[model samples]
Target chain A: MKIGAVIKISGLNKDFPGGVRALRGVSLEVRAGEFLLMLGSSGAGKSTLLRCINGLVAPTSGRVELNGVPVGAGVKNISLREQRKSVGMIFQQFNLVRRLRVLDNVLCGRLYYNPLLSSCFNIFPQRDVQFALSCLERVGLREKAYQRADTLSGGQQQRVGIARALVQQPQVILADEPVASLDPKSARTVMDILREINQQDGITVIASLHDVDLALEYARRVVGVREGAVVVDKAAVKLTPKDIENIYGGAKEQEVYDGTYGRLEYVRA
Target chain B: MSELKRPVLPPTDRDGRRQSGLEKLLYLQRALIIGFVLAVYLWSARGTNLSLPELIEGFPHMADFFSRMLPPNLAILKDLVRPTVETVQIALWGTSLAVLLAIPLGLLAARNIAPHPTLYATARFILNALRSISEMVFALIFVTAVGLGPFPGVLALAFHSAGMLGKFYAEAIENIDPGVVEALEATGAHKLQVIAFGVVPQVLPEFIAYNLYRLEHNVRQATVLGLVGAGGIGFELITSMRLFKYPDTAAILMMILATVTLVDYLSSRLRARVI
Candidate 1:
């Protein structure tokens, strides 16, 4: 891990309407060029933490800093948005505009860099269009550029989502369960792509996942969350059966771990 | 342990019995609602002097008027053409003006897109007030204010249609998938950029659909606006009727019907393409 943290979350807390405390004084650091996986069950606050890092959800208290700039609620509106341009996000649902062409959807990622008037007019410069196309190519969906986003299958749409995020040229990519909605093969393909991006481009990746075996296969660092707090934080290779038990509310960790590892080996073959 | 026996009885309430009292109360409530509806209908009928005998007695007079209106006048068709075209023009201009004015108002009134609650509420109130008054009433007011012409008729239709279109546009805006807007915002898009990309594309087909529908309605209303001397086929119709020119009246009615039918068909086709 690098010495400098790319993203810093210190004592973060988020209380939603109706007094739901989604995050409870959580603090973590993401190093430069690291593949960090956040493991949690549903409602474990992993999604909220990722959103807070990207300024989608403001922390009720504490601070989130991206590239040494404050990005949470207290930051100025313009600067907060400016900081957000450095971070890319992928959702589990692949939230592309269904009615828009895939190319237009990818171009939307560069909206922060373009002038308001030009972007509104949809007059993307040729260079940007080429760049968007190259990003789509990287995701292996170049030929699907002109297709309506909704017409694509679940896996293909998620690849389009990846292309959109990649087009931003962000230093950090935050993915909230990017493969949770896909089949096993597609999920592995997405993970491999994310891993490749992390390795080749050296962009820091923080993804939340429900699948422990996938995390073991891809993540260099793992953070386990249970009920809005980190239960375990360590290197992926160092995580033990006890840590898995702690994260999953004392399920049969040894049996699950062995079963998952066996599947991972078979999948790798 | 022996074959895992299951209950055979039908499910019931907590007391293990169906509640007859509750069922009886529900039935009674439905009966009372029907009775109240019937009573209200009868009361309204009496208040409005809507008697079946009266309608039956008036059929012959209607027949006599229709008989006099026929033996049709094809000669006045050319004279009716100019005013018919003018009525269509009025509708076209009014619909265009309403669309232009309503876009901003509708954005302001949409709850999700409005910058503030106060602005949303105020815009909604203004739209409601505008829609409450009929187009004919607005025509009458504008005619007195701006003097009789197609211009006043256009203004009246524009104002009335703006209220209706604004309400519909706001509803379309409000019904958009919030996730798309969120994704755009997460990309650091400005408010205008969010609206252009996220909101506009999703609601545009509906907006065009509503505008075409309103144009069709406005064309029909434009003819009636001329009744108040606002300049269209209606003015000619009223004049011919007062002078007992039944043939001329019949010709005017035919022209209006043909124009409205053509417009309705074209607008429906356009709407089909849009949706």
Candidate 2:
């Protein structure tokens, strides 16, 4: 099941203003069609890593190559606005244009293909509209196409976010805490959708999750991160209790899975 | 549980003593500020002919003048039709032009939307310069250039309102939810696409609301533009007063008031629909 690397990150370092170092000498390789789940606590640099891959955050000192083409802010990667086309993103906040109809928000995914003047005038091609409608159908939001985005529930909004990303037609999808703001049931629904998309479409899915049990159930590969470094990289089944502790910030406790998904109760060791 | 040893709050007397000193200082500072204000007024009012008695003595003369203007001549209503319409036209065109100009200038001046600091600074400076100059001054300047007409009046109102509208729009843009724009950028969309799809939807309602407010404001301002010979009801008012045609002046004033009131009502209703 070993596929060629689709994203090659080398020595990535991101130092924000006020001297806060978000990423420190991080390096990673994401293989094609790998269901890789990044396990980390808050501020473990997972979000920054995901952002760097999609060219949202520039590395202070590193290289991020998507399909062997360098990409990031100021990297001169994609000429003529072709950047980040291969990398789709799902956000924790869903980030939909709230006042816009769900269909229109989905159509914005095709903005990169249309010219500036036409898109500015809200003139998307007919094929693009059909494609967007299909994407909404895939996410089970075809009935909600005309409703304002803010009117949707959290789970529905995330589904719409998925539809928007699908409209981008990317090779890999980066979901940054995509279920962090969702309820447990909604979390399971979203994870199921991502798993299906990954397995059925062979599109790579990289997700950052704090729910250890859900990650174990859905992800084939687990990468444990601690303090901006990848401390454990192994097949999901191969990870030991120690790896779990490392992912959970060395808490020497047996993490109880609380029967239901998305619930973890730690018993101190 | 009873002997949990309640944490002793730190003694407040020491802090209170220090704060009492601070209070005394604050009181002194407040007195100094009030005294400074009083001194400024006292110094500045010395040569301004501040005579309440003179004003009281002049009030009877004002009453006599007002009595002569009683029962406004409704005959001038026919003549007032053109200039009043021109005043409204000036307001309509001026607001439209301001909206057109403000959209781009506001985008450039907005701290979040601006692509570069230099462009942001330049746009801010331009808007500030325009806002600093009053419409009266702008009308005088334009009247000189275009040689006295409603065109110059429109130009004056547009330039001045664009400055104000642009600032308001920039603030609206700056206050938008950034997550939407970030999502747009994540999809390989260009900057223009982000603005068009993300920023516009969020801010457009507020922008339209601001435009309605500006249009209502501009209607009143348009009447003043004719004071500099820019062609409106203001010229009629000023000329009637100059020639002591008090009845005609009252009619023109009423016409201006009615027009302003009508625009105010319509603009508010439309703004309510948008919001």
Candidate 3:
């Protein structure tokens, strides 16, 4: 009920088309400067949950408050745009516009700040361009600024995604399976960069992950979802093997879940 | 420990829709499409009174025309230069105007960019209406509006070219990655800003290539428009033929064909490098 909580969700219920419920009366809160890992199986609504917070997917019956302002309201209003400006989302696919240069992709985050003609002309202000370069430097890719995004490796492209988010100077970063397509080393590197940004810049990070070990290693808090409900919410340090087993499922339940749908994890057991 | 060999297995249907390597349903669909096309062509030919006997009777006249066309009347080439240049000018001006108008209209027709149902529908309707009428019909209409001149022809070509380019532009816009748009929106970009940054760059090269193709087409079309009193080589050729000056008409036709061919070759080479 505190006024200053960075994110607040109450009585959130989301049902997609065809009557498949992705969230069922879920309620949770996230504080500033917290690195929260959303843990879930393939169909457990990890993506749906992250999307709801930013109005990407509207909940059927729920209230989502970010920085004390409710999402899913009239999009034409200045306030909704303002709220969205502070939240940056990174996708699993490292969805950089492949034809664009790395620096241009990062500078796209300032589209809201510039006039329509300026963006259309692709003319970035000198300071903004310099700031974007620094963000790329933070991801240790300052030298790759001029290269086409498609030319970079998958891991390097994800770093460009991070750099784009950083250039936004967002208050909260939502990463949906940010390292799913990456190799083990790349996954670790991305996680470490996310954690470092959260710690050093005080930028709140809410990342959905299938890897229990990575979640335990980097995230301060872990919220596990099972069948559209938060079954467990605890500090990552306290998340036990028994908790992971429940999250992963027992032999009998695993057979039912695994037969129809595969598990969502960094590595299959 | 007893070692067991895994049983060799044949591949089963992945989605259970397999009927063999060659699908019977696909073959049936193909057959149906071919049948429909043949039936339509046959029916249209019959309805139009397109008789092979009439064509056979006309063969001699065609041969006589070809005989006259030989040697190409190159002696009159000295006087054909000005009209040929006028044709090129008409195409250039018309294409420039169409390219400018199509850039914005195409954006309006794009489903992703034009979120409002009314605007999207209106844009599509306008483009379809423009496309439905041939460029010749557009030339006729413009000639009626502005009186006899290459100016009307230029205007007509511009409008028709806009409609054709607009459709291609809409498709190119629709194919752009939605992620970039989302990223722009998250940065608090207004709708226009989002389109400028996210939509435009993805579709620019395609737009340029399409415009070049339209320009090439306009060159050919402009000559034909002049036949209707709308003022290029076609006008000169038509007048010469009406006056019974067959040699002059032949000279004009030859010049037009040569210019169109050169333009086509140049545009094709340029387009290949754009992508």
Candidate 4:
């Protein structure tokens, strides 16, 4: 019942309205303290699988057990909000409230702990504010904390998002297409932060990625999904580009690039 | 993984022969719509008895009316100040009260934030009912209930604008980035926290801008509320016009114009600075 493996997804199924199935009998057991990447083509159910893990997307059938607590609609073992507290999430869009200061955006991670009446007025406890500031420092963004979220570069914004998730002190972090919107350089910075956290803090990460090079470079384990089903699950070190391409329905990328998601690297002839 | 069967895309418009048959049909459809609109306008014009000759014939009468009001009676200028200021006060109080009323109702009505379908529908119904009834009608009712004063005028403006402002706020909330909201919710922030952290920041600028616009609009509407005996400069102007004191009426009109323009200037400046 205590935290053991971070995630256990069993026979998970999700169907959107109009009977379009996004996930089909997907099952995964994610141990605590590891970097795992899910790879698939667009609409391959990678995002849905991650969302299901955190209870963002309710599975139509099957189950997801987080820290041994079942999560889904109509299952009242624990409240959905309470269950979500132990799981952090990062998004492709960076999802920071653009109008808020970076520090305020980060502080939102502690909103659950902050009291309802005072937090509604943007007043937080001293400890929460300090922790939010420290989270910013971890991302190397303490200097930018007071600036509006919109004022930062895309990469910096993503870093702020990572810091916000880190403040949750969660058992696991689920990143859904975290770098798809960033420039290659920015993408590297964001990935490096995620990797650093996973290694140094022993926090589990289940990230969905579209880039083969990035997944191979950072993830120790990779799972491939094809048409809403888990097709390939293996160690990343064992994967060839061809293997990843197979997950993508073959040869998705013609040109090779650096690990920063398609930024061209100089080949030393 | 097996051999990939890729989707093949054909190059379009190879000969550059402009658009296809669908485009021609679309243009014809647009033309027919314009023709239909023009025909409706012609039909409407008959109902209003609109005629160029009638306008020409009435030109002299309009000129004669203007001639009677040439010299504005400056004697009544000091007396006008009290009522004019009261008009502005009504608008100020009404708009402030509307904002206070709108914020909660707006949150309740917004589809994304509403806790239940029934709550959203009820909030929407209240807002619509308030909006559909004109402020003039509201003033008439209030004036009857409160026995005629600027209090009734203020109440009228506040109720009507609460509806308008609430609708605007709801739209602003609904249109915001849902992604940001999801980011907060995933952290296990409760409903109010999600709104405070995720929704409020995104819509604050729009809320302020719209409120300023409502304040400016309310000022103009307040002046007319006095025509229903609900206290303002319009009450004074009506008395002058009925007494055939056209010069006094002209003076009140000029003061009203000046006051409206000043409020307009102040509202725009505040909007520029804040938003």
Number of the top DockQ candidate: 2
TM-score for each predicted model, relative to the true structure: 0.91, 0.91, 0.88, 0.90
- What lDDT score belongs to each candidate, Candidate 1 first? 0.87, 0.85, 0.82, 0.86
Q: Which stretches of candidate 3 lie over 4 Å from their true place?
A: A1-4, A72-78, A249-269, B1-39
CA displacement after TM-score superposition, residue B103 of candidate 1 (Å): 1.6
Q: Score the docking of each candidate (DockQ).
A: 0.33, 0.39, 0.34, 0.37
Top of the candidates by lDDT: 1
Model 4 stretches astray by more than 4 angstroms: A1-3, A72-77, A240-242, A250-269, B1-32
Report the C-alpha lDDT of model 4 over A1-269, residue by residue, as the tens digit.
24467688899887765556778899988999879999987778887788777666777899998777787443655777777777889988899999899999998888877778898899988888899999999999999999999999988999999989988888789998999999998888889999999989888999999998888899999999877789888999998767766787764542221122100100000
Badly placed stretches (over 4 Å) of model 2 are A72-77, A250-269, B1-51
Error of 3 at A148 (Å): 1.4
DockQ of 3: 0.34
Q: Order of all candidates by TM-score, from best down to worst? A: 1, 2, 4, 3
Q: What does candidate 2's lDDT look like per residue over B1-275, in tens digits?
A: 13567877668768646666779999999999999999999888877978889999999999998887888999989999999999999999999998899889999998888887798999999999989998899999999998998999899989999999999999999899877877888888878888999899899999999999999999999998888998788999889999999988888889999999999999999999999
Tens digits of lDDT, candidate 1, A185-235: 999888888999999999899999999999998999999987778889999
Model 2 residue B214 CA deviation in Å: 0.9
Docking class of 2: acceptable
Question: Candidate 1: where is the Cα deviation over 4 Å?
Answer: A1-3, A72-78, A250-269, B1-19
lDDT of 4 at A167: 88
**3 against 4, candidate with superior DockQ:** 4
lDDT of 3 at A267: 8
Candidate 3 C-alpha lDDT tens digits along B192-269: 877777787788799889989898999998888888888788888888778867767777888988999999999999
